[model samples]
Target chain A: MGNVPAKESPPNSGGRSRSSTYSGSGGGPFGPNGSSSSARRNTTSSAYHQSGGFLNGIANANDKRSKKTEEKDRLHRKHLLGLIVRYTENVDGGYLAPFGTYKSNLDYNCDIVRGLIMKRRLAPFYTPLQDFDESWTNEELIVILNQLPLHSIETAYSNEEEEDDIDNHKIHKSTNFYRRQEQKAKLKELMLQMKQIQKEEENKYLEIKSSSSVGQRSVELSSNDLLLRLYRNATECPICFLYYPENMNISRCCLQPICTECFVQIKRLDAHPPHDEEHNSRTNNDSEDLPHTLISEPAHCPYCASSEFGVTYEPSLDICTGFGGIKPGKFRSVDESNDDAIASSSTSPSPVSPRKAVKPRRKSSLAINTPGVISIDMIRPDWEAKLASARNKLARKAATASAIHASNLIMNADEDSYSPSDSRRNVGSSALSNVEQRMIEEALRLSLLDEEERRAKERREERK
Target chain B: MAALPKRIIKETERLVSDPVPGITAIPSEENLRYFEVTIEGPSSSPYAEGEFKLELYLPDDYPMCAPKVRFLTRIYHPNIDKLGRICLDVLKDNWSPALQIRTVLLSIQALLGAPNPDDPLANDVAEDWKKDEKRAIEVAREWTAKYAVKS
Candidate 1:
């Protein structure tokens, strides 16, 4: 993922060798005058001279040269084989050809060769010679000896050409063999790379699809669970008059999902109350003579049967606690009335109890007997008022914040304009969002209005 | 299917345990990747007393990406369109792995409280907000009263 440093060679500094020849028409081995070839030859000869008397002079020199040439040929073949291996590896590693044009397999082989040579030049041994100029002379000689193999390799290839004519068919067969092997390796690598890329893409696609699917599944499961819990709680949908199923349309309120149809019905009933003309007339007539009752009753569930039958009162704990600490016989049901009387007798006060006790009991009875009042209509208006006030407060806060944000943006813009650096300009250019900029402008206008209003108020106060 | 990203799972759990006050969210039992949420309007905003529903779905690479959230309930805010789509940076380019459902919902609630007309999803709302904020706010309040309020 990081950049790899490129390798380069220093310029060669020796004169050209007149003996150097090129079969193909081109410039010198290292440009005009064959400077590189002469330099290399000199370096090798010096190295040979340094190893004096190690062999039988002239004859040994020729023999050594021939042997080295043969070795060079072998090494060249090995290098070619290595290049083939690397090409195949790169293909398998998912390297793709450049867009627009198709590169021949031979081109790939050439690239491998170039890469190897470039790497070799970057070796530590080829470090700059300026710091060790004195030793570099000798080092240069060794380098020349090291490069002698390149010359021999070229010579070996030429020698093979002369013999190639006699064994033309065999030579072709061998070349074909090498080509096939190289091609096979490259093909395998290409297949591997293709598979790897395909797999990666496939995985990415699956991830996106599965995530949404999982989310959907989770929603369904939770809905089902909610339905089950509601069923277990013994709550039924009023509209269907049936227990909730795993799948059904449900609207939630207070952690409960009611059927939408039932909810609509409840809303409708709560919004409108039917008036009974006879009951109203009777109540109007009694209102003048009867004492006003301060106590209000709790509202019963609208959907309950008792609500429709005019039998809405329920004997709740609040009723018991409020009235004289709940007298034993007082509010007993018909079935328990006899038992209640007996219990009352056991807990009855002594006959000798004073008038004070009787007074307190009467006060407590009045308090308890008077049920707490709840008016659906009254609660609704109070809630509406609260909601309105809250909305107003939020609007005020939003206006203030928006003003501050606008001022900050203006300040930033001013700063940006004053700054001269190109980097700062780049930063500002990127910061601007067309939509956001427009919104800010609107917010600024609002801020200005608020500011004007505040200023006007201040002026009036000062005058006062 | 690839396993859910660890960051997303952690964020989801956090959102569930310490949900935004007005927002009630629950992961689906059948699949832990999806969430159903109900958000109550903040008392101080024009949306007060309004209840809005939303759906959130996590992608496989959720933490590295972003959850897909869409309003199921109709709303009238500069950043929220009639189609229920929202235009917020956190849901787009500004998305960071650190953001969670709680933060997202909170951001959305904040957005309702103070719509960014500058980055609106609804062009008409933005134009009205720019030309006459009072009218824009009135429209928003009207929508809340008509469509969002539970009553």
Candidate 2:
């Protein structure tokens, strides 16, 4: 079932439209006018500015309100429990104090949570705190994760079936070990503590969910999605519209993100600017003969078109690669072991069991002891016909688009139109899952019936 | 070309199951990547009480890039040109992979309400909008009534 609550009324007709009314407010963090705000902010002593001072007083009052809001935010975070951290290198064995107790590394002016989180001061924060951004060298994160006795430092969890399998249980046990006795002892204690924390978080999630008003507002905090729960706010980068990569780089130009790999890719595109310019100038000429000066042009922000850009901060370590960094066994189960869900689904049938287990017990069980037992002959003919039909459709679309798009650009169907027929091979796997085979058969039979229906219609016309 | 990603399938399913109010986007029978969409003009805008049709296509590199969309029905707006191409930022520069078909449509609907004459796709329409705001709005109402009638 979908995570959303059961529809009381048709969700399609839900009062979402009212909520979607255009606020006319933009998302720029600076101000309403964006870049233009800075220029207006510079005006200090104009003739009209004397009266503007009166307006400034009102602005100061608004600032006081914002300050109150900030204080309220701090109070909210202060209640949350923090780790009592101690530096192992201390000669006198200093007291295990709150992370804020260390004034140098932490920004004491900010609240404990922000100081520990925003500054990326992970060495002192040992309570399995929030996830840090991708740019943090990943070295400190390693130390912090190691100290986290609760979550396993190895063995990343994945989506279902593997946990249920009897064979994997032994493998999981064999991998559990420690290099030192002190570490071993800590693991058991941490495991108990983590279980308690998980229970508390579960309760918190439910408490929030039960309150219908809070449910909509606190979706990120309430969500069990690894990145969502960790970040507690932003995840999707504004520039690429994708989740920020592990080493996330924020462009200072417009405060939008250029995800790590995308940043690198964008730079590569900017690297051959001279060649590109030359290509444009040369018309039909290839770029091979251009004088290559390795001096790359400054890359512009895709959204803002500003050339001044650099990595200001990392948002979060590469979250897209299926919670790959966090050990699977560490944090409590979320929706599913998300890491290898796609990989496992595609390759569900255990290759080793194929030769040994001949009997088909479940409907999904494959019957195979010998090679080539299940031949492709059954579905091949139908697949070929489907491909042929798809090709015909593609050709017709291509001809239409090309003819009409020359001037009156109704469609800009690129010459390299994506052919759905080409994907048949990918779906027609040799190691066909039992479910997949049945689906193919059902489709083949359905197509045959459709063909008969058409033939009958033709025969009826002849009789008439 | 690779097979259509699961993201496309998921987006299509959600569009059908939990459709945006006053908006319907159905994949064409001929091409699943192509969508035939209809949006009722938002109230309080010049385009109100009008049903406008649109053509939206998810190119192969969709989500990474913006979906190719244009108004099929003629519209008289400063931001939308004669060919019905809109000058919305998200449709070009600000396109993010996180945005789905639903969000894009919502943005377009919003654009109808707040026409940015300063940055216009239809220069002549924008000039008309600037010179005579009342007459421009009247023309818009007329165009919506004539060309954007619900089929």
Chain A TM-scores, per candidate, are 0.17, 0.19
User: Where does candidate 1 stray beyond 4 Å?
Assistant: A1-464
Candidate 1 global CA lDDT score = 0.39
lDDT of 1 by residue, A1-464 (tens): 00100100111211111111111123333342246544544532443344344323334446544554455445444433332211112110111111101011111222332332232210000101111122222223223222211011111111111111111112012222343455445555543454344345335434543464555532211122221121222333332232322122221111223332222122102111123221224342332222121112222223331121111111122212111232211332232443343335433321221111122111111111233311222222222323333333334334434534554676587575766778766656555443245444543443344344434534443543
RMSD of each: 41.3, 31.8
lDDT of 1 at A285: 34
Give one digit per residue, the lDDT tens place, for model 1 in B1-151. Answer: 2233334455566676776677877777645666777888877878888888877665433443456677777787888876677777777544544456776787878778878887667778888889999888788788888887563
Error of 2 at A444 (Å): 66
The docking category that best describes candidate 2 is incorrect
